[model samples]
Target: MSEIIKIDSIDNNGRGVARRDGKAIFVDGAILNETVEANIYQKKDSFEVATATRIIKESSARVTPRCPNYGVCGGCSMQHIDPSTQVAVKQRTLEDNLWHIGKVEKAKVLPPIHGPYWGYRYRARLSVRYVRKKNDVLVGFREKKGRFVVEMDTCPVLAKRVSDLIPSLRACLNNLSCREDIPQIEVAVGEETVVLALRHMVPLSDEDTQKLLDFAKKHDIVWWTQSKGLDTLKPLLTNSSDSHKLYYDIPQFGLRMFYEPSDFTQVNPFINRTLIHRALNLLEIESSDRVADLFCGLGNFTLPLATMAKEVMGFEGSETLTERAMQGAKIHGLENKVSFTTLNLFDVDKEWLENLGFFDKMLLDPPRDGAFAVCKALTEMNPSLRPKRIVYVSCNPSTLARDVDVLVNSGSYKLLSAGVINMFPHTAHVESIAAFDLVC
Candidate 1:
């Protein structure tokens, strides 16, 4: 049975929200403020999930999706909406989260930061499978709401080089004896080179290695084989110097960062640069200021802060990342100005926070979980130990909202400004930055 419902808004996952019998129905492929004919697929206690069978009335913000696989591919959800309006939706989502979840109003809304909508994903993990029934190898992201991979010849979201190689990759994998053994491919793009790490459950034969080398030479793709874990990854084609390392540069700060393929780096390099610039501007750093960067991965923000401030302390829970950050600092000749420390910010308390010494400012770039423990510690610290200004970069808005609530309600801080960064355009993921000022 088909039912018509008016989409009231969109959810965090980009699904449209509609009310039916006092229950919230999440409809796939429906735009906000538009009426859709949907067929319910799954029913839950409080809400039901449906797929829009037909668009009875379309939204003014709706636009034709560029990718043919947009509806089925799990890579993107908001591609159907206009690129500019997509950022608007994300901004509204962030504001709504702050007001509803944090129970506080933002003193100022910073303009959204955005970049290209296509070919912006420099990092991606694609699923691979040899389908005997289809007599071909499928390589791409998974289908929407399915375990099977979406068979795509190209991905518009990926860099043109990576996207253009999808078919060739499938052909190469199909010819390999260990095709069935390969389960995943990690794509990491740098300014000068692209690396593809193939995860194989079984070891590749000598003949397979030669075939990979040939493919590498032919397509100019750096091939890496991972038999077990990330640590086991090695270049299939020896003497591939480009595959030995990957790095990006912050030209504004004259800094370069090198990282291993498996390390965590932002998928969008343009947004990352802009994000760093915005964060530094908001921190109001001075030459005499001593800044701490919590959860700093690979010295993304720490290195830049070190260049601007007298001394910067970078703390991360992962010892591997801390070591990498230190190396980056040394490479940039900022080792004396910046220090990397292995500390678990998640488990921080008043004693640990106070022991870390004083800082004039802080930059926190935590994972989706947010820095609740650290924020709580900040609230409990003596006024003298607290940093005057804090800039937080969050990947998840709900967690950010929750943490900001604690910061404002308990930490004696005021929410100065907040805004969204379109880090992953055409997706519902919102990367945001917020500034907080300590109350005197």
Candidate 2:
């Protein structure tokens, strides 16, 4: 049945939420304060999922999406919503998660951090599919709610240079002798370089290599071929030169950190720099203060912390990342002040926390799974050993909420402030940061 419902607010997944017979109904492609005609497809005892058939009333926050494949492509969901309103919705989602799931109240809500709505994604893993029937190569993200690749001519969310290279990349791959063997491309854009790491199931022939070389020379990109795994990725058309190097700099801290194309780096460099600045500010690091950056990938936060603190120690699960972090420290002339160690943060226990010693401040930037183990370990530690302040940068709200609950309720910490960061604009991915202080 077609039901007309008023969208009261947006859910965390960028779906419009309404109520039908006291049960919450989620409608896709609807906006807040708008009345949408939706067809309920999946009905549960407590809620229903629907797709909006038509909009009887449109919201003022609705805007025309720039990408033609907005709804069809699974890369972005909130493209139809205005940038400011998108951030607002994300902030609300963060707040709701903290309150409802974490059972913690923040004294203040930090204003959402946002940047360019388009062309902000610096890194992306794109799928490659050679459609036999279509006699064409498909290179882009997956189709909405399906495993099929979305045949995209351009992707505006990627760096403009990379976005413009999609059609040419598709053509180059299609022309390759082993086109069917190529399955994926990892696009990484640095401050001064662009790298495309192509994953191949079979060895490239001499002709395929030459084609890749020609494409690299034509487009001015460094190509890497991965035969098996990330460790197998090697330079295709370029040597170990400045042109092939991938690095981003923090002029404010006089630091430039380098990493391999497969290393974990923030998708949005603009928001990343801002997040580092905000984290440092919240840390209030003194010249004599020692800081610990857990789950620190390639010293994204450690090197900057070292700039103001006496000593900074970064710990990560991957030894490769730790090695890169140490190299970053050395390049920035912080080798003596910053140290990197390999530790499985997800498997952290109270004994491990005790062995790490004390720090004046701590910063943790974990993946979408969050840092539940470390928080639990912190809760078990003595009050005096706990860091004075803790800043957590999280990519998932649900996991962030669960970890925050452990910190505030059980770890004897107070949630001073928390807010959302729009790292992936036009998408439902919620990147957020929170500050916690030891309860007196």
Candidate 3:
């Protein structure tokens, strides 16, 4: 029998750690400062896997999860813990990763960026399955450890408007001729509009199309259909030009960016705005300075930076996204100040860096893979062209820490400040921003 130990604290991954017989046992559904009886499932030499069987003593941070399937649905992990505590845990996780893994400490820890805990998720990919045995269609996120879709009538994390339409969507799909053919639905909610991207393995009949159109008209939602790859996505009806765009206005910068449903966008628009404001503040660009916005998706930061800088050069891997960014700049009449180029950032070279010319300030918002090659290339560039200041927006803590190490130890950049952004409230995903300044 595996001995149970009191969980001392929560780890970066949201698991609670307890020591039993000199071995670290990780228990799920256990909170910090709580005594829980856990049942060990997997026993390893140095570590063990366990699930909380009973809560002997509860932590003050523990709260009743809003969703009945909170523990079973993989969509959220920290819902059982208070929202305030969730943010605190994430902030500490960011600091611990930076200090222990990166071997570098930030000069300052900025206050964490947080927003509405519930009804905050504006984007989600919901799995769809038709369970004939249950005489119903299962939609929403998958069950925590199970492959079966959670029979969710509504999702609390989804925007209130979108959450209310979940049942209607399920009913509409359930009645379609090719109900079983539909595998998933992608939800993208913007300031004024909501788009649903239906991924179908088979073609929809005329009746099915009309049913979808009727549903769209009834709910005042936009319907987009994807038969295959991303490029194959198209509107179900011909008069959806206005409905297809997801719009958000950045009043602070006097800018608005429109995007398609399938495009990459911040799930939480509120926090996104906050993050952009913070990054711009950290850059503290002078009117004479030129900035480079690497991995600039649809000019999310590039256009805002352009308003303050003399010139802003944006680089992205997708030609489609680059063209969209260019269009956005033109729409906002900032094209004169903003320029964009399409290049694979993962394999950036010294030649590419030199071709881009000199930049005083840099903003890198790379994906989870991190911008190792881009950072390395910048470090190897001619001294005259190397950016003096850099702001890195990262979605993964470990990679951020690793890249921070490279910048601090080898690239002669001093860590300025680092902090977490609670973009996804209930999940373990961590979004962080760090600033670095070149040391003369």
For residues 291-390, what per-residue lDDT tens digits would candidate 3 score against the true structure?
Answer: 9999998999999999999999999999989999999999989999999999889987889889978899999999999999887787677878788999
lDDT of 2: 0.90
In terms of lDDT, which candidate is stronger, 1 or 3? Answer: 1
Least accurate stretch of 10 residues (summed lDDT) in model 2? Answer: 236-245
On lDDT, who's better, 2 or 3? Answer: 2
**Model 3 pairs whose backbones collide:** 72-144
Model 1, residue 211: displacement in angstroms? 0.8
Residue-by-residue lDDT tens digits, candidate 1, 1-440: 57889999888778889887789999988988999999998899999999999999999988899998989998899988887878888898899989889988756999999898899999999999999999899999999889989989999999999999999999999999999989999999988778899899998899998988898889877887789877798777667676656889999999889987788999999999999999999999999999999999999999999998999999999898999999999988998999988977899898888988899999999999999999998999887999999999999999999999999988489999999999999999998999999985
Alpha carbon lDDT of each predicted model: 0.91, 0.90, 0.88
Top candidate, metric lDDT:
1
**lDDT at residue 83 of model 2 (Cα atoms):** 89
Q: Candidate 2 residues 1-440, lDDT tens each?
A: 78888999889888999986899999999999999999988989999999889989999999999998878899999998998988988898898899999998756999888788889999999999999998789999998879999989999899999999999999999998788988899999999899999999999899999999889889988988899967788888556584447888888898888887888989899998998999899888999998999999889899999989999999999999999899888877899999998978899898887887888899989998999999998889877788999999999999999999999988489999998998999998889999999983
Please identify model 2 stretches exceeding 4 Å from their true place: 238-244
The reply for model 1, stretches above 4 Å from the true place, is 237-239
List ranges where model 3 is wrong by over 4 Å.
1-3
Question: TM-score for every candidate vs. truth?
Answer: 0.97, 0.97, 0.97
